[model samples]
Target: MEWHQPPAALVRTMNVVLRGVLPSPLGRGVGEFMLLAFTGRRTGQRYRVPVTAHRVAGDLCALTPAGWRLNFRGGADVDVTLAGRTTPMRGVLVEDRAEVARIYLDRMTELGMRRAARMIGLKFPLGRLPALDEVAELARREHFGVVRLSVRT
Candidate 1:
């Protein structure tokens, strides 16, 4: 499917959410999640995509499909807003595929398969989690991207 480019205004709104409202409510429901604002390098438009957040080692990280979409995989930087603070995060793009796998496994389990799967954008009514190894493989190859945002204290 062709990628959808979010308008400039939407990007601004997302910036407000990620950099302004996500940190304090760190582990809340995904709905409370403000979309991780990303931009299309070629189109220069903004896209607001809601993503699960994790504050690890004092920095916040955002995850996306490895090979599933364009708005993120094709983008270079990510913007996260939390608690009224906005920060333009440069993309580090996890280079270690294994690390990606491990991280995804942790995230999925943290969210809970039957409960948080839907929130994370996974649709599996069967309520079964793919084998951990299988999930890792998909995470490694399936258009995934990770952008780490630094918290401005």
Candidate 2:
């Protein structure tokens, strides 16, 4: 699968919009997005970004193919802001492709096809989740995996 490289301007615009919107009262209505604030293990610089929140077996998780997700590779503490509230949490990156795909499938079904498609940046019909094989194939090809977060307090 080809990686989707959105234009730099578009990415900057989205970052600005998400930062503004996700912290506002209006954010409560957008349950799918959360602001994750973590210090870069290497840079010692704080980074914050909006990510789609996925629920896997009652726990909050996020699947990403981005290099930034590597900051959680060895399990890191993060501040997750969801629905206009911030909480400390531990984020662990799970790289097992099959497991990630299974969680992705579950999340897709749980979130419904439309929302899942929007999060995945794909367009598909609204009734059914992506097939397991299809999801696994994409997950493998795209290096997609999950970062499951546990609340700290």
TM-score winner: 2
Q: Per-residue lDDT of 49-117 in model 1, one digit per residue for the tens?
A: 555566544656666663323444423666665443446765455656777666666666777775445
Per-residue lDDT tens digits for candidate 2, residues 39-131, read 999999999988888777888987788888899998999999899888899999996888988887777777676666667554454345668
Ten-residue stretch with the least lDDT total in model 2? 120-129
Model 2 lDDT on a 0 to 1 scale: 0.81
Cα lDDT, model 2, residue 12: 86
Clashes of 2: 0
Query: How does residue 86 of candidate 1 score in lDDT?
Result: 47
Q: Give residue 8's error in model 1 in angstroms.
A: 20
lDDT, candidate 2, at 5: 46
What 10-residue stretch in candidate 1 is worst by lDDT?
66-75
